[model samples]
Target chain A: MLRPWMRCSKNWRAMWNNFKSKFLGTNFKRFMGFVKKEFYHIFRDKRSMFILFGMPIAQILLFGFAITNEIKNVNIGILDKSKDSETIHITNRISSSPYFKIKNIVSSEQQIEAIFKKGQVKAVLVFEKDFGKNLKSTNLANVQIISDATDPNTANTVTNYIQSILQDYQREINLGIPGREPIEVRSRMFYNPELKGVFNFLPGVMTVILMLVSAMMTSISIAREKEQGTMEVLLVSPLKPLQVIIGKVFPYIFLSIINAIVILLLGFVVFGMPVQGSYFLLALETVLFILCALSLGILISIISKTQQTAMMISLMGLMLPIILLSGFIFPVSSMPWPLQAISNIIPAKWYNLILKGVMIKGVGLRFLWKETLILLGMTVFFIVLSIKKYKIRLE
Target chain B: MQALRDITFEVKPGELFGLIGPDGAGKTTLFRILTTLLFADEGTASVAGMDVVGDYRDIRKAVGYMPGRFSLYQDLSVEENLDFFATIFGTTVEENYDLIKDIYIQIEPFKKRRVVALSGGMKQKLALSCALIHKPKVLFLDEPTTGVDPVSRREFWDMLKRLNSTGITVLVSTPYMDEAELCNRIALIQEGELLVVDSPENIVANHTDSLYKVAAKNTYMLIKDLKDFKGNKSVYAFGEFIHYTHSNSDFSEERLGEYLEAKGHEDIKIVKARAGIEDVFMALSEKKGTEV
Candidate 1:
């Protein structure tokens, strides 16, 4: 039995080598030439060049800086009626912190409201008269933090930061007392709850860039051929429809992969956001999502007649849904049931989950098999639909 | 939107055929149907002995098509476009360089330049070279000289004539009637219908009516007075003179000159003129309009 199996293996190996040589002879040259032409086309166009490489880096950097929780140089007005060392010390501490910048000081309580009304400050700190004396005698004092509510989210963060600074001052002043624990309340935010890390936005920006370059660019380029009449020449040539499509998308696939690598590097270096899981698995999943987007691009190009229509449909039709309903910004669980059901159909939604899971959650394939399967399923569905929609001849 | 109806013609293997018509005459539609880029809703056609519908893949491999528009990749350099077309047909440019060398040599100096930087005539030449790189049995050129200057258009036609002489059957369409005289055979088309198909000599020779070229100092009044005349069947402005044909076969130029004199026209000239393809096309289309 062992001898027969060895003989069969040798025969199969010879057949495989023969098949490889035949296909690699003529078809390989044709395919490589086609790919080279596509590369020249993309490299020579300045707009396409900007979209391909420049867009990913610009988008990643902009989003990385936008979402970090660091609130620096927030202007504020202080009303200090108490002329004492303790009041001055607390004011010095608030100004020293990076979060607040004191723009003005008011001697009267009425002037505090005037500063806010004048828009001279985003927030105001008011201290009561004789604060130092009251704290020394009663062991308690009050400070009021009034913030502008025009932007409620920033106001909340500003007020929360001021309260914590005041509490810190209270703890520092009470340290000399003996036989007291001071009732310390230490709060720890788990898994980057401080929102200081750029990890939360990394996946969202990567999805948007990949979708824009991979899907929108590919669709518009193919439609450009149609508009310019080059597609008619291609159709009349000996190239098969599948070969034509592969030739057109080969350069985009390479560029999209490079774009993904650039985004990951920026996330790691500029943002210090690391992938906690295996890099190999992340790359494989990324390739899967790119395939899905490319297939969608092919479908769009088939239906569109010109580059303008392709660009319009890709941006207004595909990009909007990926940004809005992919849970990249808003959580899917919080969405209504109908929208949640629709979101399940979007590949970016599943890919976003997989990106977060592998990069932030440190989960392996076993934990993310469902999302991976959904993405894989979407890839196949889009590819098959694109093939069915591909037209061999102009109508 | 029936773009064509009952449009039929055939080209011999070695003869150069021209589809002569004006714009909107459905020449491009027929070219598309033959090149396997479109499907006919009612009729069946074959290209080089292969059915366009059933054996479309073979038809595509057999014929080379240059659309009415300049359709090559404008961003790709001239050499790159040629090499790309050659490779896709599984043949290297060097292998078929003999076929395209005559045409490609003119644009060789600018082979490194992108197609967008090329002039209208050079772009047309490059397009033709790319179409011929594979050395197809038949070539379809649709309005190849629509936007070129006079010198370039003449050079472009000279190349086509040379290609035809080399035993490559050429099916070219043009809105310019003068180019019709250069082909071995021609088809007069208008309004999605074929008016007639014959050799250039036969088309003009077949014009039955006796045509007279009428000239006067006041060209506008000459046409007006002729249209007002009763015996003339058709009056058209052909170049600097008005070509008029009468209803009766024996109507003389002297009689027409006398009629113009009565209409207060001075220094009138009328002579029996030999008909050309343009004269035949106009008459045939006007006849077709009346029949319809």
Candidate 2:
């Protein structure tokens, strides 16, 4: 009985030897040179070097800290028009709850808007005059909770917290008064109910990693050829334009797939994310995603005159939209109609949806067909544009 | 051979054909078209009898192009860059080992070094090896020696001569006039047009104006005063001397020297000399609207 770690190390060594034998053939010397060259490029560019390694860590930390579903210690402002015992009791209950922290108690309505503008308060709770007297006679009271909806998600969370606090008070009142009929309401959240950010983020990370590695990296590489004057050499060679593009993009595609695998492994082992659908289908989708990204890279390369311009275009034009409109962190369904319409044009939105459906829901082609078709269409469109642009440059 | 606007000249097999021109003289544009990297909107061009556009793929297979800049894969090692170019032609360094053996041997010790880490000369040799890896029939080197040091330029030219001896047609472009003399045939082009195409000696012999090299202690004043001489056709500074060629037969070198001396000039030395290719090029190219 061999030790597990030792056995695994020996197997890894064997696989490594096999891989070397296959690619390196009799020339281990040349293969080492190639790998050294790849390392040189990875290390020479400080920005890309950071993005290659540091970005994932930063994203994880940011998602873990800033973008959270669980709301706690949210700053709330209360306005009590009546200084009665019932009003004070409700105010104490609201403030003492772990979820809400009252930043101020305002006596005037004008102070509510000023406190909100100063960013000291996230939500303002208001109680009307003679609220205890009204509750005693009519057995009903109305209170208003106003939240700053600049960041709609946080605003929504604050409002929900206020509503829950109010309900707790109502429950206490109901217990005191017997024979009171309580209409029961049950709530169920759709899609991701528990709001595990990783569950929502892993697929988004996959899209971004694939796009950055495939599109931005490939475009920069191609534009680099033009900048260095090697493009002319390749163009003048007997190799066709298609052959040249294929050669440039092929290496990146392989590298991006490897990157994708690294991310997926991290997602699985570290985050405990399970792949519900067929691994083969997921791999197929990854390949399709790579093709779409590569075509976009080709298109970017065609439009750019230098590596810098290509990189800027890929960053500002492509990556931003993918991150913002793809419904990776934010739900596209809850966005304004104009924004929803705009999200439809983004390829990452569909890919994110497809990944969620396949990995989380175990849905197959029936659910993913539209996304696949959209990706394919985008690929074709980009390929055609790049080809046309390439021809024009030649002429 | 089909002409670029009635200029018909063919580079003999294994000949070093040079295009000497200034910037914007269309040297790169012409090179691009001939190398199959671009298509000329009009007129016909071919490499080794294969049309540039129709037979582009074959031409690409048959030609080795080294553009103005050192354009090997910089991020890759010298050896990996070499291997990649070799692989592109469906061959390995071992298969065509003899073709780049000389250049490859020079950079062999640095095989493990990344191309971006290599010196300018090393980069040049690597590019040349990558270009010749496919054993091309026609080699188009576009200003390959432009920014390189003098020694490197000489070394590069020597390598080209060596490659040409193997029966590969070499078409080299350069802005340096001295390099034009090294070519078996030279084309002088300016302003997107070919001015003259001929052997260096023949072009020099075709100088239609009389030439004189006049120098004085006050060389600056001599040039300034000589330009104002009534019978002088052209008077321009060449090196430390003023070269004044007369169009009027009545104008004498003695009279010009006398005029310079009267202006308080010293060490006046006037001599009749043979015109170089550059002089002939200047004379011909200066003629506005002169067609090649």
Candidate 3:
């Protein structure tokens, strides 16, 4: 026992020492050390390296080209038996519509199958004999549109485009003619007038990449420590649970941001995608979405005991749902009602809505506050859940 | 249902304490509990005058633990791994270089090499260095020499001795009974219960029996015949001989020799033998097993 004043001074010294040790940015520096080790892990491991850098580019290219769903510059063959002015007029009309390029004129019907089998042409237009004479006297003419049915969707889209072009020609020819009426249905698709799938895929691919790079990579890396038994060592150290979680998650935030930027840049430059809303809002929302995914990743890591289990859960659990329920590939509205309701709980679905609002729809926070709040709420929920789920010891 | 039962022991400051047990003798379980990495069901444990559960944060700061498995990052270079652990513990390697210099220097030549490329001995040295980087007051090592070569195991024990002399309380567990002799005191644990706790010399000294090394040509049959001996108290087979202890203190070797001779044994060599830590361990374990 000592005098009160002397005891108070000793306590003061102890407090200062504690403060200097615990605070004063030592934790920050230690957190940085953890992050530095994480970079070593990501850089030295080829699987993480590839997913961190290569997958974004590959996915962008894949979605940009493979599933474009646009009908542009499609080569087509025309078999004209009539050799009349009307037939020539229709052929020129089809060629100039920007949907079809007349590759070659087939003289006989047999050549149509030959070109299609050779994969030279996607479709062929065949006209019957005396086509102009029949249209003038009988008020009717038949033209058969034969398309390559290997890819049924592309074939259907091509057929629709050609049919629309033919209808446009008929409307132009029948305008103001006596006793002859051809109904015209003019439909306009807003925001994307050319009906480019790239516009849709920009957000879709962005959603998928952010979810994967943030969630899957983080979970796998964390599970990797558990498998390697370094997690036991980490727990035994002076590092707090918060420090470990943030240390394990912060690098991925940085990397996922890089991935976000890469996806946005590719979508903007390569595919001519637009960022119609505020760039600040876009970046903020991107980070929020990334945080949501990172927290989900932490939750996944908490549940998994091994890297293989984490990978399987990420791929089978996260990827398919993010790709499917997020409306990245298929429209959520078209899905069955139960699935549509289930999509509401998916963070990707909400992030997809926000991304489309800001990037494609050119709407600000005023218009997208609901989706943004939903995403923010989901992020908070996941963070809270993961914090609850995290283990403080090696149980 | 339980990993450790009624296990109790204390290590004085600066003592090299050893937990001697077989593979599944709850050595790792006890270590984990003391390190604050695990919880006990029925009892409480403390480390460095702090409760393991309530003051776990403080205990974590004061102790350095090396798990049974190799737990360092395999993909990281040796220097990088050391730096990483030092940093996470809120200290730099240069700040605590003197603490681990003895062990770190042995593997420093391979500092830039990945841990996966290092040999088992070098890895153990590096692991010890990493554990010591923070200069913890107490060190818990679980099976540090389980897979190491004989020469490296000897060198590792020497390092542990040096570290212990530096005023760090070392609590190490090993399945090798011979290594227990190197410790200042050893606890023989088996099946979640502690059998005995004493210095290695005292444990062997307490084994008061006129032990004899009896070997014959038919060694395999010797095990059965020796077990069938009515006067035998304990019979454990060592590498070249079967160590035997008789119930009677001053049993005559000539009478045993005559009995074996009548049993058609040749090249029979019966001579006195001294008990080691291993023999004591086997005898204690067997006694415990039979009692249970």
Candidate 4:
């Protein structure tokens, strides 16, 4: 319906409009410029870079030292009512083993509770008074092991050690009275057969490092703009808030990737921990986790007015949950129902699961689908909340 | 009423305009609205005749805004900072070389140095250079000379005047009344309200009262005694003297000296002095008091 020249002019106008919008519009190139600026801030500060890399290694070593299933030299108080040779032999067997340290030989039942109250002893091995008559007639004797349940893992390990010692002692005594068939129970540890502490701590380190690099660092960067008054300048620019946030987060994403590589390398070289699954899958999951953390950081930045508030929010809101509820060091199944319910809300819990699933179990997408879906949903929810808050502030 | 009450003023091409006020006088609110950082609750504003909200991208490309505080990328080197802002506007320093060359060449030696390490005067110069790097149609500097030394302040104004000669609109805001004289026109604002808008000389020429400077051996005592005098209309302490306007002009300098002598004063001097923008500001603000 239009003349050829007119159509050409219209098309030319269209092309100019398109060029202007694309060149200046919230595009990858423009956003990349903003992101490059953010990287400049991060790379310029050597302290933050050090924290991003060094914290993971330091935390991994700390958690590794703090958590161990192996029981060694557990302090104990023995309450022996009978001073018989058989009872003394049993006490010697218990004390001679590396697992139990005989801190006290209390002669009274009342002292048993005091020893535990003072916190000097973890368990009390009690031998009831019998004069050896019961063992001679019944061919069986009982030794009771009472343990402090404050730390259930320690208590559980100590019980297992004492039981194994008792079984060995019983076998030696039973051999003297032959013609008896003994029933033996065998146990095999699963997942972490050697029960290396580093294995347990590596996943936790990954969760913490991802959170610090992706959430805390990003929040601080955004808040720094608010502090320096540059945020106002950027806001006044033609760039949309989404474009600005994307720019701010892009560099952090790259930094987190580098951080992940460093942590994986440290876990492999220093700790000698292996990633049983595909490295590609681990890297992919790490990137997804970083996205979730960055969304959370943006959400925090939207809520906080200053850098101090952002830092505090990140520390209190993210650190404890990542350590306690992520099933990083503790088994989630062993936790109470209320704690288990609370852990489900923390993103780090899902991330820890994904890390363990991939790095330890070598599972496929089928095993990590639910966790991945939850992380994606959290990312979306955080982003939506931040946008809503930012809009409210703008209004 | 609009949040800014439909502020409508135009800076002639290559002219310098000042919006003078204290904090919370709606000076910044207006600057923000004009810069496209905020939208008014009602009415509209534009820069370079492009609607602030609709044509913000073009407006942004056209204007260089220096906020009330010195806000540049302090982490970046002075040179990198200039280059970054220049690139954002899709131009190079070489393209608009002459625009900011005068200001940039001063700090050019420290170009590779971080902006944070620069002195306040140097920082101000760098900020102005970045604003001018894009060769903007209009430059908005909000309180650009607030905390600088008197020498730096004078130098900054000289730079602004030079920039104005290049046919670029320069709009600045400051609470300093002396700086108001440097502008072609200024709007006096108080408590989110614009009281008066006119040239600095015109505002001073329009001062309603005959002002006099009275001093004695004890200046503070003289000021206190003058306030209590029945004939004294208004008395404010100026440098080295007390500026007093009388209720009536029937009294002469001899009478003022006699009055001060009666009030236990000596070495009295009373002489007529030229009124400044601050005097006019005090008079106009007092006349419009408690209304904002």
Each candidate: how many clashes?
Answer: 0, 3, 0, 0
How many pairs in model 4 have backbone atoms within 3 A of each other, for residues 3 or more apart or on separate chains, i.e. clashes? 0
Best by TM-score: 3
Q: What are the per-residue Cα lDDT tens digits for candidate 4 across B241-281?
A: 78888778786777877888998888888899888887777
iRMS of each prediction in angstroms? Answer: 1.0, 5.6, 0.7, 3.3
User: Model 1, residue A355: displacement in angstroms?
Assistant: 1.5
Which residue pairs clash within candidate 3? none
What is the per-residue lDDT of model 1 for residues A1-395, given as tens digits with 9 covering 90 to 100?
56987887879878776876786766677788888888988898899999888888888888878755568899998888786898899889889998889999877777777877888888888888898999988877777888888878788889999989988888887887874337889998755565654777889889888888888988998898889888899899878888878888888889999999999999899988888899999999999999889988988998999999999999988889989999988889999999999888888888899999999878899999999998888888888988998888986
What are the C-alpha RMSDs, in order, of all predicted structures? Answer: 3.4, 6.2, 5.8, 6.8
Q: TM-score of predicted model 2?
A: 0.81
What is the DockQ score of candidate 4, to 2 decimals?
0.40
- Weakest 10 consecutive residues, lDDT, candidate 3 chain B? B221-230
Candidate 3 C-alpha error for residue A306, in Å: 0.2
The weakest ten consecutive residues by lDDT in model 4 chain B span B1-10
lDDT of each residue in A5-30, candidate 4, tens digit only: 88878799887778868775535445
User: Which DockQ values do the candidates obtain, in the order shown?
Assistant: 0.81, 0.40, 0.82, 0.40
lDDT of each: 0.87, 0.80, 0.90, 0.82
Shift of residue A64 alpha carbon in model 4, Å = 1.7
- Classify candidate 3 by CAPRI docking class: high
Decide which is better by lDDT, 2 or 3.
Answer: 3
The parts of candidate 3 lying over 4 Å away from their true place are A1-22, A96-98, A103-120, A136-140, A175-181
* Candidate closer to the true structure by lDDT (higher is better), 1 or 2: 1
Error of 2 at A158 (Å): 3.8
